[model samples]
Target: MSSITMVQAVNDALREEMRGDDDVVVLGEDVGINGGVFRCTADLIDEFGEERVIDTPLSESGIIGAAVGMALYGLKPVPEIQFSDFIWPAFDQITSEMAKMRYRSGGQFTCPMVVRTPYGGGIRGGHYHSQSPEAYFTHTPGLVVVIPSDPYDAKGLLKAAIRCEDPVIFLEPKRIYRAPKMDVPDDDDYVVEIGKAAVRREGTDFTITAYGAMVAVALEACEKAAEQGWSGEVVDLRTLLPLDEDAIIQSVTKTGRLVTLQEATKFCGFSSEISAIVAEKAIDVLEAPVKRVSGFDVPFPYTLEHVYMPHADRVLKAIEGVMTY
Candidate 1:
């Protein structure tokens, strides 16, 4: 085991996978000699050379489209989008080509690729640099959406995504990329299963379901709730597309109250999907209406970035509302 930052853990996973699998290649703008904008792919070019660590032009569409082609031809491509906010140019390619490859070809074709991008706020990046767009990809079928909150899950889940037969959208929370350090397994075979949810904390009073950076905020709120004699269980949704419905339902059933949290906008966000699941399946066990603490329905602001994010205070307020109801 080794204590490292989320960025280091990601680097380790990419390095380990590329070393083990000759088909695994890393490509994106500034991903080669420049080591990516966030340095997540740093030092890879030195070890793997330019053939495997490619630096493409500043075209998101081209980066992803080429990855799809490579995947179809038997190469495992890991493309970096730089930032979630800049993934729009490649949205059509991702949603239309890569996602539907398997089904559209009647299982004759498969794109086993992983698209990595940094997402969420808290880094003072305005609208252009910071955005939580996981919902857009999660809504698409045949794509796996994953967001990790810490170093351990980040490394494990990323390794799993690279090995997955389907295309995986790995959204790394930039906010906590270097803020917290944790002991992550250094074993090359270590992997966190995809489509599984992790329980960060255990309680019986209420449940808080969150993912990505919001998992930390939810855990902080749980600590405050304990002071008020309310115990809150926190569930980290590792994968959003093949959501662990059983884990969520089981958590809500025990707590009798649910509070969904995310950094995305309130309307039509991933939080709403989880809230709907609890409402439809666990309505009988619900003690109060399922509450959601999410960003307002507006563009992320430069001056109000902190205000726009759903913090511990906002989550705590939602917890109180649901528990008191």
Candidate 2:
């Protein structure tokens, strides 16, 4: 095991996968020479060379369009969009081309690609950089959505995503990119299965469901809830699409109370889907209505980012509300 940050673990995953598979390639702006804006791809160019670890133009659509071609030709391409906020330019390519390739071709062609993007606020990136747009990708039918909250899951999930045959939207939480180190397994074959939720904390009072950067906030709120003589079972939803409905329901059923957390806007956020799932499938076991703690509906603010992004205090309040309901 290695105690490493998420960025290091991600670089390790890309290196390990690229070493084992020659068909796996990474392409994005500054991903090769500059090692990405967050340095997640540091030194990859030296190891894999420019051909494998490609650095493309500052065009998201071009990046995705080229990845779509690469995938169609039997190569697994992991294209980073620089930031989630900048992904809008490639929305058509992602939603129409990359995502629909396998189905449109009737299984004759599979788009084996992973669109990696850093997302969420907390880095003071202002409106142009900070955005949690996972909901948009999650709504796309043929795309697999994944978000890892820790170093271990980040490495394992990225490895799994690269190996997957279908298109995958891997959302990396920028807020927790350099979070406290964790002991990630040294094995190259280690993989955290997609479409499964990991329970970060076990409790009987309530279930606090979240993913990506919000997982940390949820855990912090859980700890605070414990101080208040309450227990919150924190669930990290690593995968969004093909969701682990059973795991979420099991946690909600066990706790009989639910509170969802997300850094995205409250209206139509991924948290709303979780809330709906619980309401439809586990309503009989509910001790209260599912409370969603999310960012404001307005565009991601610049100066008031701390106030806009959902944090431990906001989640703690939702936990208290759900428990007392």
Backbone clashes for every candidate come to 0, 0
lDDT scores for all predictions? 0.95, 0.91
The model with the greatest lDDT is 1
lDDT value for model 1: 0.95
For each candidate, give its TM-score against the true structure: 0.99, 0.98
- Which lDDT tens digits does candidate 2 get at residues 2-110? 8999999899999999999999999999999899989999999998899999999899999999999999998989999999999999999999998888889899988
Question: What lDDT score goes with residue 286 in model 2?
Answer: 94
Residue-level lDDT of model 1, residues 242-286, one tens digit each, is: 999999999999999999999898899998999888878989999
lDDT of model 2 at residue 231? 82
lDDT of 1 at 285: 99
Error of 2 at 79 (Å): 0.7
